[model samples]
Target: MAFRLRASLERRHLAIDIVSAIVGHVAKADRNFRHELITAFGEAFNNIVIHGYRDRTDGMLDVEAEFSTEQITLRLSDTGHEVDFAGLKPPDLDSLPEGGMGVFMIHALVDEVVYHSGTPNVLSLTKRTAAASENDGH
Candidate 1:
């Protein structure tokens, strides 16, 4: 599935819903997996709007989702400012911090995550299903 969404905070929910539907179809009957995907995608989208576009409503975000029997992949592209992936480190849980947890949560929830910086920066995330892991030896 593919979507071209405006980079606006108000449209975040819509993006999440579309992602949920695609994830559902891929996971078959795994509602829990579906929920997890939604949460991760939601945070990622919010980050794009807040940090990438700086909350500008005129920018556009391109999202493309691909699914297989074992995994789901999401690619988010935007023509906003490029992200400094090197600076995106996992938050320190030893002490309480007020902000900067989105990237951490996204990395934790998904099996693999990647970011490419360019004219249209792209963030690609892949998550393998629990069922797929269980059936690996079969």
Candidate 2:
């Protein structure tokens, strides 16, 4: 009941294809994915490409997506310079900043995001079903 895909950061464009494939598989398990989630997945991929590999070199980006009964988790790992999360601040979206919005977008769109540091920075983005949340309200 587990599926996986991996690729290099050097060919970051391939991330989109992997995302789509994961989305379809996750949808099969839980039939309630919103367009917002789709957009968030795209942003998450971009985050790894930019933040995780923003240097003059080639590296590897490893992504593993897990779908459970109630949620889907995406783990993006990169072998680039370690990210210093201590200095992260929300960008001003009103002024139409050209960059630095991906993390904010991912935070706002996904239900949960967790980062674990090691040789490669690993970020896990989890999304809960709205249907499940609505059921909890009752």
Candidate 3:
């Protein structure tokens, strides 16, 4: 990672803007900032503002993003409620669920999503570049 950027954002609409800023940093890591990456970032931030804080205005959300020449890792931490990843099943689209797609989309867009819970809850999402994968392929 070149450098880590961390921000304690308010739990509100501006959360989207914060997410966009992170996406910009990911683009800076490599010129190829895919929409798939941005989509995942959006869902991650929405999860923080919505489920993480239970839509309460009293809590703050912290986002940390690391960018390197090959990949970007975004770690989101919140002091709010923690989610049990073991039970974090993808939404059943067959039922046309009105909600719960946010986490699913996040998982789909990123190369990996890991959950950590302690004093502060954490959800880390990572995406590797095509170039990086090409190196692995060899």
Candidate 4:
């Protein structure tokens, strides 16, 4: 399923809930996978609203979620400022930084993540289900 949302912080929860429900229905056998997917979705949405749009309600966020028998793919695009995807690094665990961990968390939970810095910024995240991994002999 796919939908368009306003790039507003207030709408973050709604977006997360919608994606969670869809993911849950598509991949109901694994609760952990569903949880991780929801977490990644929330982080990506937060980044778009807080950093990309700078809390501007005028910007729009486009989200598309595709679920197959083996995996799920989420594509999010926004018109806000592009994120420096290459510059993102995992937080220093020893220092215990207060912020800048969203990208790290998103990467950790998902199998593949890619960010594009174009006229309309895009973030694509994909995760293979545990069942799929096992079937592939991974």
Using lDDT as the measure, the top candidate is 4
Question: Deviation in angstroms for 45 in model 2?
Answer: 3.1
**lDDT, candidates in the order shown:** 0.81, 0.63, 0.66, 0.84
Question: In candidate 4, which residue ranges exceed 4 Å CA deviation?
Answer: none
- Which candidate number maximizes TM-score? 4
lDDT of 1 by residue, 20-80 (tens): 7788777443777777777778878878888889846699999999898678999999988
TM-score list, all predictions: 0.88, 0.72, 0.73, 0.90
Writing each residue's lDDT as its tens digit, candidate 2 over 16-113 gives 55565666655333433645566676676565556656663456566777775556787777666665433268888789999777677777777777
lDDT of 3 at 73: 81
Residue ranges of candidate 1 with Cα displaced over 4 Å: 85-88, 135-138
Clash counts for all predictions: 0, 0, 0, 0
Pick the winner on lDDT between candidates 1 and 4. 4
18-101, model 4: which lDDT tens digit per residue? 887778756433888888989988988888888888856699999988888678899999889987554366789899899888
What candidate 2 gets wrong by more than 4 Å, as runs, is 1-10, 27-34, 84-88, 135-138
